[model samples]
Target chain A: MTYCVGLKLDRGLVFASDTRTNAGLDNISTFKKLQVWEAPGDRVITLLSSGNLAITQAVISLLNEQIRSSADTSRTLMTVETMFQAARLIGSAVREVRKIDGEALEANADNFSVTFILGGQIKGEEPRLFQVYSAGNFIEVGEDTPYLQIGEHKYGKPILDRVTRTDMRLGEAAKLVLLSFDSTLRSNLSVGMPMDLLLYNADSFTADRQLRIEKDDPYFQKLSQDWSDALRDSFASMDELEV
Target chain B: MTYCVGLKLDRGLVFASDTRTNAGLDNISTFKKLQVWEAPGDRVITLLSSGNLAITQAVISLLNEQIRSSADTSRTLMTVETMFQAARLIGSAVREVRKIDGEALEANADNFSVTFILGGQIKGEEPRLFQVYSAGNFIEVGEDTPYLQIGEHKYGKPILDRVTRTDMRLGEAAKLVLLSFDSTLRSNLSVGMPMDLLLYNADSFTADRQLRIEKDDPYFQKLSQDWSDALRDSFASMDELEV
Candidate 1:
């Protein structure tokens, strides 16, 4: 299981992913699920994946492979003209992985499920965020819906739903994403940290701030503590059930 | 989809279940998932069901039928010697439902899944809580683990994890459970309002405080407001990424 979130605010895009991956209680491992495609000032694309590790790794490899070949492949995330086209290229990569690995996984009684949140900007285009489904179809985050989450999403959703809107500042949005992740990490064992956080400032067309937040990182630790305290105080202040 | 949580505290037990049921995005109806089988001063047993509504209803019907014929049968929830025996009776009821309806549901590609959280106490026995699975096997909540959740559980898990401990008071535990439900309801549209809340005081041998919280209830409205405000404030106070 995994938890990843992408928020495309008016100021920029914020992406966060947990590093925990588990096949069972015994076979837990850390796998960085965020991949960055940067071509300096030309384009910056970040991919946050959650689902089968093999499938996501394959998708990333295929993207990198295309970037390496650079001959017959006229379409790559770095060369794509628009975020929409880049999303299509990613969808194709996901479909390619499904074509190669779906059947054997089905035979073993496992559903072929993989999903991704692809968000970033091209040199000429504005920052955009998309949630690509297991079927390879995708939806862009609109003005009304500025954030997307995949994997173990529900535990952290209430805070996002109540606190996030389309016009939040980049720093505020980043804090919300981390707080949301913090909520999920506290509750769920499947989602562990040393989180990969990427904050891109719009029109800068570069990865402005990318930080790996560890479990004991002061900011995150404080966020977790303060959030817990706030929740308790909020709960206490509510009118007690008269029954 | 539904959200239900049951907590076993030193003082007693708390059980809460949402009433919304949806077959798809277009079809949603309100149906109570909380059921009580109480002989007042002698015993007070509450059952919260999640998963296939038909199967759960069948199981409840079977239990009720047994209660009607208690004059002939030597065992029922009321006559059960221990809370463990009460769990087995509930499991047996689930298995009886599977025996009747499992195969046909499989023909439609639906899995035979129904889970139950049964809690409370008989006059002579200590209070206990059990999570009865689809296979009719159940596990009792140990002292180390004080709570259990079934059905769309993840979204609301963080608050419960952070707030619940072995030494928590019964009233405090009840408040936290409500906050947990609020978190889940905000995140997932499938789980919704008109929730069933039951809190049993320890050794009371009967349930005296049960609540049906509707969407517009004053206390719930206030709690939801405070939770959102508290979350936003906490997010704002967290330090920004130094990068």
Candidate 2:
């Protein structure tokens, strides 16, 4: 299981994902779920994926292979004219991978499943966000719904519903995402630390701020401890229900 | 969809349930999910159920019929000697209902599904709480897990996970449950207002503090608004994550 969130704010976009993956209780591993593609001064695309590791990894590799070979540069994410086209390119990759592996996975009672949150900016377009499903279809974030989440989303959703807004500052939005992750990590064993965080400023055309938060990352530790303390304090201060 | 919670605290037990029931988006209704069976100076048993309304309503009616007939008092919840026996009686009621209606429901592609949280104090035993499944098997709440929730549970779970304790005061516990419900109500359209809340003090043998909070209840309105304000305040106070 995994938890990934992508937010489109007035300033830019923020993406965060946990690294833990488990096949069974006894077989757990760490894998990075955030992938970044950038052509400085031109475009920046970020992808956060969850679900079947093999499918997500295959999709990422396919996209990377296209970028490395520089074959048909016009069709790659780096050269996509808009964030929507980039999402379509990713969706197509998902479908192409499913075509090759879907039947075998079904025969073994495994699902050829993967979901992704794609967000970024092209040189001429505004930063946008999308949630792509296992079926290779996707929905872009709207003005009222400024964020998208996939995998183990319910536990972390209340905080985002309460605190996230289009006008929130980039730093504040980053804080909200980390708090959301903290709630999910505490509630679900399948989601753990060593998180990847990327903050993009609107029209920057580059991911200037990216960090990998490890188990001992001081800021995350402080944020987790402080948020817990703050929640308890808030709870304590509320008046008892009168009945 | 529904949302119901049962908490086992040292002082007694607490149960809260939303009253929304729906067959589809176009077919929604309000039905009480909390039921209490009490024999003053003897026992007080409260049941909170979630799942297919037909199955749950049938189970409740069967139990009520047994109470009305009084032909088998020894086997009824009213005459049960222990809380465990009360849970067993309720479980039997569930299985019996399934025996009668399960096949027809399955033929219609409907699940004869119902789950319950049974909590109360019988004359000779300590207060207890149990979660009964569709198969009529049940598990009791333990010291570590002092709460059980059913239906749309994930959105409201993080708060209970953070604040509930076996030794917490009943007033504080009530506050916690309401906040948990508030979170669920905000995130899910399927779970709505006109909630039922019941608090049972150990050895009381009667539920004297049961309240039905309607949409216009002043206290609930205050609590909901105050909780939202407190949470936003808490979020604002947290230091932004340094990028």
Q: Pick the candidate with the highest TM-score.
A: 2
For the predicted complex of model 2, DockQ is: 0.76
Q: List the residue pairs that clash in candidate 2.
A: none
- Over the stretch B1-243, how does candidate 1's per-residue lDDT look in tens digits? 888999988888889999989899899999999998877788889999999899889999988888789465668877887889989998998888888888998998999989999998988778889999999999999987789999999877877877787666777776787788887877678899999888888777767788899999888888778778876776666676556
Candidate 1 local lDDT, A94-161, one digit each (tens) = 99999999999999998878999999999877898998988888999888877899998877787788
With a 3 Å backbone cut-off (N, CA, C), the pairs that clash in candidate 1 are A154-B155, A155-B155
lDDT of each: 0.86, 0.90
Docking class of 2: medium
- How many pairs of residues collide in model 1? 2
